[model samples]
Target: MHPRSLRHRMEKAAKLLVIIQKHTPEVDCLFAPEKGEQGHVVCEFSGSGMSRSNILQLGKDLEARGYQFTRKANPWLGQLSYTGKADEKPTIILSLPVVKDRVAINEDTPATPYSFKEA
Candidate 1:
């Protein structure tokens, strides 16, 4: 491995640490090598209160800091499981809802869509 590349990776890791520390204290952050991959660093964090907007903003922020973000999908429930990877390395796993549940209106309720036809 080239010394320059190693140094650059170290710098990135340091910067990521600082960013994580500054933005999220309640979240648990982990830095490790990607599974089945070599010469790559993966950052995984898990937290609550994660929404789609929040995740989008987070992605933008990470991208600005030289990290690529991808949102993961939920397998079982088919919902957003809140897991994303940055540069295929820095990954975020959130335990929050990306979409809200549908609210069912009562059948007896008068609230309904109205339609008018020209006479």
Candidate 2:
């Protein structure tokens, strides 16, 4: 990738991070390239209360501001791709990391042993 193009991408990513931070104050945001990938700038956010609906609403807000964005969904995760210009396809990929709550098991709890009988 050309240095100029990379610089442009970095700038765009920074702009996006500002917008995200303004809207989603509770979430943490970052602007950086994907590991081992060239010419790709990704906007990553992770924190409690970062739900899919919240992200979709953010995308809508961005679109209302004249920015083009698309939401990509997965079974357990989702992201928004911001393509402000034709040449910059998905210049920024907004990622919301899904964190699952873990329950701690108490060792003091007694477990009952069960035996299965052959039918």
Top candidate by TM-score: 2
How many residue pairs clash in each candidate at the backbone level?
Answer: 0, 0
Segments in model 1 whose C-alpha atoms lie over 4 Å from true places? 1-10, 34-56, 77-119
TM-score of candidate 1 versus the correct structure, residues matched by position: 0.43
Quantify all predictions' global Cα lDDT against the true fold: 0.43, 0.48
Q: Give the per-residue lDDT of model 1 (tens digit) for 95-116.
A: 4333433443222222222111
Tens-digit per-residue lDDT, 30-102, candidate 2: 4445422323345465554766666566666656555554343332333323333224433445665534323
lDDT of 1 at 22: 54
The lowest-lDDT stretch of 10 consecutive residues in candidate 1 is 110-119
Task: Give residue 8's error in model 1 in angstroms.
Answer: 5.7
Model 2 segments beyond 4 Å from truth?
A: 30-46, 51-57, 76-90, 95-119
